[model samples]
Target: MGAEGKTPRMTSHDAAGRSDDSDHRGYLDGQLLIAMPVMGDPRFERSVIYLCAHSSEGAMGIIVNRPAGSIDFPELLVQLDIIQKADQIKLPENAESMKVLKGGPVETGRGFVLHSSDFFIQDATLKIDEGICLTATVDILKAIAKGAGPKHAILALGYAGWAPGQLETEIQDNGWLHCDADPDLIFGGDVEEKYLRALRKIGIDPGMLSNEAGHA
Candidate 1:
């Protein structure tokens, strides 16, 4: 799930329009989705996703805690033409330190940037909440290349998608648990800790979480 082109940005209306309808049913926009041990989909096993948009129509999220193994940030910058291999050394600390993640099982060829609300691009950035924004445009990449981007960001290749009623059904089947998003858990450098930490956020101890689904 790797591609280099114009990043696809979500519009405010597209991401925010369904909130009121979803709030009534407990929509999970801007929350963390922690895959349960019983998650049948191996692709999502032990994954932690940041729900970017959720509605009765469907849901979309980026895997916040899964790293795209062997994919380094600077190397990706060069591959995407956002920077030259020779110029990688000149990147600022935050830019150089950005993490590349395997966002999910969908659109594995595209890229999405989940970032702090401090940076924005008119009509290109979707403000998901008070502290988070989603920008898929290349300008954010360029800004990060120059160390001028958001203070914290995660560059995810691909995303997780669900059909209408899919996510809710999974939850009912004991396939996932969700909690309020924490900046550290979303943008932090520690990929391995996110899953367990997310479970803990909901007052669940990972060890105690059963891996079996039940109907009773």
Candidate 2:
């Protein structure tokens, strides 16, 4: 059900940002935020994200499968100054081309990698969990340039972050539905149906969803 709070403001700057989305708080880390089928918010409709961090203060997640419009994989590498061979840019065989995704509306120039924790950025890597890891350092980019990165990976140009209590309020208000995230859902699935599919993963039929949430 929607919370007793108001919709949080979308701020422009990081430091200047403040949030009111939290009337409640907690993390659904490693969980999936599946967009409700009736959602009309352009930013989140039909989106599926993996919650990486959460607390009473705020939350952050990575949108795994939404490709940034008109932007292909190899083109993203070149934009990031990573050179790829013409013969290998779109190699016919097996190679996950360097690509970019529309992570969120927050930052348009930043990049983040959401991959299995089985791959680490050396020893000092910040591990999210036993199954997932996030490496933002340019070294990881360099590793990707050399094709030495993780087995399954998604490159997001931006991210989705909510302020303290913001995410909680949304959940309480039912802005998003929760489900256990699947690797296939995040890395190799059709994003067009990902939200609905994720809901199904948890046995929640999308047809049962209603835009107006209520506490019974």
Candidate 3:
């Protein structure tokens, strides 16, 4: 929502939009939701959303391309009042420590770790798929404090969420086009390219897309 109007409160439907007939159950599990050119919502224009979990209950994902600024892991630690030696460079497992990412516009103050399955939160972990997971507990942080965290990770500070049927409606309206989810899309590679790249997974050049998704 940044620079745009306040993040619209997600109701049972998306942006209070009219209902559409597009089926969304096919969007379950690992998928990528790419914002079409006609998506008027400033928050999503050119945005690529990595769908972690989608179902009748609701939908959840992360915005991979948004950067969290120059702040890194050690800087975040200092902000959190966790003192570490100035010489103690690098993350717990030799990973980049200051790689915090802006996950979404909502809950800008919260944090979510979208990471590979090599690490678990011991108890507080959301398994998004076979190879990806999300952790929000401090236990994972502790592991990272000593450089013992997962092999691959991107610490995001929020998440993209949707109400049941809301996302389905959007898909129907051509607001979003989806494809099979990829781990690298969520936690690896260029964040900004994820959305466009996702569209390519299905061989759909986003540039050639028509706002009106006409189903025959």
Per-candidate RMSD, Å: 3.5, 8.2, 7.4
Error at 75, model 3, angstroms: 1.0
Give me candidate 2's TM-score against the actual structure: 0.77
Collision pairs in model 1: 1-108
User: Per-residue lDDT for 21-104 in model 1, tens only?
Assistant: 524458898888888878889889999988988898899999988878777778877877778899999999988789988888
Off by over 4 Å in 1: 1-25, 214-216
Native-referenced Cα lDDT, model 3: 0.65
Q: In angstroms, give how far residue 156 of model 1 lies from its true place.
A: 0.2
**In candidate 1, how many Å is residue 117 off?**
0.3
The positional error of residue 134 in candidate 2, measured at the CA in angstroms, is: 0.9
Q: Rank the candidates by TM-score, best first.
A: 1, 3, 2
Give the TM-score of each candidate: 0.88, 0.77, 0.78
Candidate 3, 32-99: lDDT as tens digits: 77777667788667777777667777877777777776546665654554446573564454444435
- Evaluate all candidate structures by whole-model CA lDDT and list the values in order: 0.82, 0.64, 0.65
Tens digits of lDDT, candidate 2, 10-92: 22222112333354234687788877644567787778888877767578898865777665555555545555556344432
Worst 10 residues of 3 by lDDT: 6-15
